[model samples]
Target: MVESAPVAEPAAPVESAPERVSAPASEAAASIAPAPTPAPDLDPGTRRGVPPVAAPQPSSVPPVVESTPAVAGTAAAASVIPGTAALPVTGGDALVLRGVTKRFGSTHAVDGIDLTVPAGTFYGLVGPNGAGKTTTLSMIAGLLEPDRGTIHIGGVDAAAKPLAAKRLMGVLPDRLRTFDRLTGRQLLYYYGVLRKLPPAVVESRTADLARAFDLEDALGRSVSDYSAGMLKKVMLAGALIHSPRLLVLDEPFEAVDPVSSSIILDILSAYVAHGGTVILSSHGMDLVERVCTRVAVIVAGQVLAEGTVAEVRGELTLEQRFVELAGGLSDVEGLEWLHTFSD
Candidate 1:
């Protein structure tokens, strides 16, 4: 059985925060960090995890990396050059988006955002609610059409040659919807089959992924019986079966338990080390800062900052920098009625 989550000491409030203090390590961390859970034993796979409770990773000074500018445009639509090649081609960049925009009636969910993710990078996309993070990811995944701009996946235009582009990617949507009646094994088998893998290969990979994700015992149970964390794990396993070059995941770690999150992180780190690219959206600033090689901060559908964690979060922690870029935590004043409640 997976060990229960660790209980770390709570952090002091921001008002009296210390300068560069490392969070005390959790007792469970020592036991969990060892060989009980090894990295995924995969032949090869694609894709890319909570309060991942353990030692709180501090965002101390990171090495300086130059920023990559993503300029916004007032224009509603972008023009693509006619006769451009749409076939898949190898490129140094794993993904690129230029002047991307998505409109929902009057609202511009994603407004003129530009981003480039290099091959083998673990990139994080972060923003507050309705900041176009999801919208931007959806467009890249080909779930939603952008009003303007072009997206390329491994140099294959996502909009112009969507099928070819999708072939290079594995996506874990923010909303988790699946055949809940199916067993975890069944789900993974079906995923592999859909990816055109032979049954024999799918079976072998399924067991490998299940063991890595600690779902070996749960594989027989229907997905509906699984907890939120298990559901995420199964879906993540399904996403990786095909071994696509790029993984576009949105909120990949939300609601995940600490143990599962740690396993997933290990798997992703290994995958990136083996030359896979991951672009994921997350709300955990510290987690992103620690795991991601690059990060992009989007606010009001515009990229406010883009670059290495060091460059964007200069003097402050990632959370503090995000709050500053996101309009500085909305003046906290008027709640006098709450102090004198009816109770």
Candidate 2:
């Protein structure tokens, strides 16, 4: 049973601001020293009363990078290129990609990346900006095609049998746009229908989602009027309407209020507990460490490391490990002119 969510800490009011004080650069760095690695006992899943599963051991595959061109258009409507080889999948991984590569002009966004996500795992993907995290996810979600290699969702070849593969997954990309003219409820209904769900079932699911997302009062209003946080919630609701076996989310918590973030976490935790898989990308290392059972650190279009949170981050915080892997921590150079001033 998931423990009840804690009340969100309210933001301090504007008038409560404190005066700023000048500090030495060394002192500043000291004040922000990487927080101690959170105690394993405090993992959010365990805090929520869910017995955290033992994370699988790290993969031994050395990281490799390869280049190819980006495919055009959205995953939902993209046509598979002819002669794209389909790879056979063994075992029961929920998602598998072999030699996936994508290029944008002269830049190779994703390069010959291979990944395997096991069933019922809460996996997190972390990388620096422009590191091809989104590109790789887009390909896996069938929104784009890899110039080389194959992708499989639940053992269904996404390139050769996209419709079949797509039916088993829900995707929430970094950018989401809903039909502005449709009411929030209408938007979910549309997605339900698009997924071929029965009308009666769609209605029932839509109601449940609206209540879960706390959008009951806004259901009849045009989605165009919803706040950014509300929009995210509604889009997420649409993603879940079909009860997909896998979920692919890129930065699902960004721009969300703390309360909503907690709600989303609870929903995702429950989903994973019930045998679903989720692969999400986020810059928030703290949140990733708190929730994800497994994680991969990607840099320059290659996965530098892959394993359970504790395994990859051994003796270090995930943020520290990520910085070390992506680009080793270095002291600031040539910023000697920065100084605090007061009248």
Give the winner by lDDT: 1
- lDDT string for model 1 (1-343, tens) is 0011122211110000001111121211111100011122222223210111122422331111111111011111011112211122233898999999989899988899999999878999999998999889878877678899999977878776655566666677677765666678877765665544446655765766776778889999987899988988787776666555677778889989987898788776655654667899999998999999999999999999999989989999999999999998675589777789695
- Please estimate how well model 2 matches the true structure, expressed as its whole-model Cα lDDT: 0.62
Q: Write the per-residue lDDT of candidate 2 for residues 1-343, one digit (tens) a residue.
A: 0011121110000000000101221221111110011111222232211110122212221111111111111221122222222122223788898898888799988888889999778899999988889888878776677899889877778777655566566667666544656678776765655544445655655665666667889999977799988987887776666556678888889889997787677677756654567899999999999999899998999989999999999999999999999898677887676765656
lDDT of 1: 0.64
RMSD of each predicted structure: 17.1, 19.3
Cα-based lDDT at residue 316, candidate 1: 94
TM-score for all predictions?
0.74, 0.72
Question: Which residues of candidate 2, in runs, are more than 4 Å off?
Answer: 1-91, 329-331, 340-343
Clashing pairs in 1: 49-253
